[model samples]
Target chain A: DQQVKQNSPSLSVQEGRISILNCDYTNSMFDYFLWYKKYPAEGPTFLISISSIKDKNEDGRFTVFLNKSAKHLSLHIVPSQPGDSAVYFCAASGTNAGNMLTFGGGTRLMVKP
Target chain B: GAGVSQSPSNKVTEKGKDVELRCDPISGHTALYWYRQSLGQGLEFLIYFQGNSAPDKSGLPSDRFSAERTGGSVSTLTIQRTQQEDSAVYLCASSLDVGTAVYEQYFGPGTRLTVT
Candidate 1:
């Protein structure tokens, strides 16, 4: 069972525009959520994260918004650049879970310059 | 300040053969995890090791799949009698520790295994 799901398999946006990636989870026990960016033939790199208690967290041009009631969270990249094109994965872990993360299928973002 | 590293970046093995993949976690990091990613699929948890505690092999697909962490530093994942379906990229990650605090996991480039 996939606890975390990224419904959109791919997204395309113009450079300098806003890019929004969405993720949903079924398990309410998950307390921490994170986003990772992955390029071809490379490992995923950490992007940003948010706690269950917080609704939003921002880092530089990336922002993550969480809605506990909806079991939904989103990653927003402002002024999206061509370099932002990659697969973004949403992962979650609960307390005492030993940091074992459940990752989503990932959304492929393409920024056209 | 090296990140996680995996050996044999690419492996091509025939069916019924056995393959062992290795992972070297970051120095001083006590948590290690193994995951498999198939084409067009998300990462699948395989196993986890934390300090000297018992390893969590709950996510292992079958008895043919196993992992071992030696000295709490390097880890090895073995897949015996590999099948064509066993083809995938095996990824290794390490984190400082596990607790209430959210620990970011650093991943290696991964070992791409192809079972022919």
Candidate 2:
């Protein structure tokens, strides 16, 4: 069974628009959530993270919103640019689970110029 | 300032042949992890090693897979007998430690292994 899930396989957005990617998790023990961006053939790079204590975290054009009650989270990118095109992965980790992260399948984001 | 590094970016071998993949973590980092990504699938945790503690091998799919970390810096994953189903990209990551508030993991370019 997958503990973390990304329902959307891909998303497309126009430049200067907003792009939203969603993820869901079944494990209630997960307290820390993170998002990573990956380019083709490259390793994933950490983007942003949120603790279960906070409902939202933002950095520049990227924002992550978490709904603990619903076990869902969404990443929002405003003024999306062509450089933002890549695969986005959502990962979660429990405090007691050491440093192991459970990752969602991932959503491919394409920002059209 | 080097991140994690992996060797033999791509490998192809016949079925039943054994293969070894290597990973070198960042200097001074005490935690290392291995994962496998199948086509169109999320990463599957393979193993983890922290300091001098026992390595976690719970995620190994079967007895054919194994890994070892030497001096807590470099790790090698070995497959006793390769199978076509074993074709996938193996990823390595490392963190400073496991007890930190921000358990950020830095990853290395994966090694793509193909068993024919």
* RMSD to native, candidate 1: 0.9
Model 1 docking category: high
Please report how far candidate 1 places residue A35 from its true position, in Å.
0.2
Q: Which candidate ranks first by TM-score, i.e. highest?
A: 1
DockQ of all predictions against the true structure, Cα-based: 0.83, 0.71
- Candidate 1 Cα misplacement greater than 4 A, ranges: A96-98
Interface RMSD against the true structure, candidate 2? 1.3
True contacts kept of each: 0.76, 0.58
Model 1 over residues A1-113: C-alpha lDDT tens digits?
A: 78999999999999999999999999988999999999999989999999999999999999999999999999999999999999999999977554799999999999999
- Model 1, residue B53: displacement in angstroms? 0.4
Error of 2 at A62 (Å): 0.9
Kindly report which residue pairs in candidate 1 clash with one another: none
- Scored by lDDT, the top model is 1
Model 1, range B1-116, lDDT digits (tens) per residue?
A: 89899999999999999999999999999999999999999999999898899998999999999999999999999999999999999999999885567688899999999999
Residue B25 in candidate 1, Cα distance off native in Å: 0.5
Fnat computed for model 2: 0.58
DockQ for candidate 2, C-alpha atoms: 0.71
lDDT tens digits, residue span B2-69, model 2? 99999889999999999999999999989899999999998889998989999989999999999999
